[model samples]
Target: MSLRIVPVSFHEACSFVDEWHRHHRAPQGHKFSIGAANEADELVGVAIIGRPVARPLDDRLTLEVTRMATNGTPNACSLLYGAAWRAAKALGYRRLVTYLQAEESGVSLRAVQWKIVAHLPPRRGWSTGCRPRTARGTDNVARTRWEARIAT
Candidate 1:
């Protein structure tokens, strides 16, 4: 089935991710969100772009794909990834990044020309002794960071 990129609200995207994402819970917030809709106008997937969670990369010009979830729709993810980069560039951002669990084959990202930039080893959960946070089961899982340059 063909898919078209469309605007999505943060709440709407979060709902979809909460129901569909395999490895992640819904994100806390986002700069923007995009959706993929099939010919029937039903949402098949969503991408949430937000400020980088990593402090060093949280500059004004960089954004991250904080969450992307789909109902196993073919090409829906690649469509959202490509659309997110184009939208970011149009809004003057310089780069966009995303992370995938090591177990995932990043075929969708590669389909859109996103390059793997780093292989991050598993780490302790985000919680610190002083700043305790809830465990989301993401700790101790290796991740691959991918990036794409926004066209000038």
Candidate 2:
């Protein structure tokens, strides 16, 4: 089935992610968002791009695919990943990155040419004695960081 990549508002994308994503909830915010629509014009997926959650990677030159969710539509994710990278480059960003839970295969990302850059160890939920916070439910899970450089 043919798919179209279209601009999506942050709110709309967040709503889609919340409804369809399996591993995590919608992100706190995003720099921008994109959607994948089927030939019939139904939204099948969304990608939320934002500043890197890790403070070390939060420099102006980099952006992250904070969340991506789909209604099990084949190729929807691959399309979103490619579109997100292209949009980032056009907007003058040098690098685009995203993290995947350890259990997730990076096939979709690989199909779009993103590389696995690092494997991060698991962390306790973001809550600490000093700064208590409710867990978003993904703490203690290992993650793999993937990245693609914007071609000049």
Q: For each candidate in the order shown, give its overall lDDT on alpha carbons.
A: 0.95, 0.94
The segments of candidate 2 whose C-alpha lies over 4 angstroms from its true place after superposition are: none
Could you tell me the lDDT of residue 40 within candidate 1? 97
TM-score of 2: 0.95
List, residue by residue over 97-152, the lDDT tens digit for candidate 2. 99999999999999999999999999988888898988877899999999999666
Assess every candidate by TM-score: 0.96, 0.95
lDDT of 1: 0.95
What CA root-mean-square deviation does each model show from the true structure? 1.2, 1.4
| Best candidate (score: lDDT) | 1
Residue pairs with colliding backbones in model 2 are none
N/CA/C clash count, model 1? 0
Error of 2 at 86 (Å): 0.2
How many pairs of residues in model 2 come into backbone collision? 0
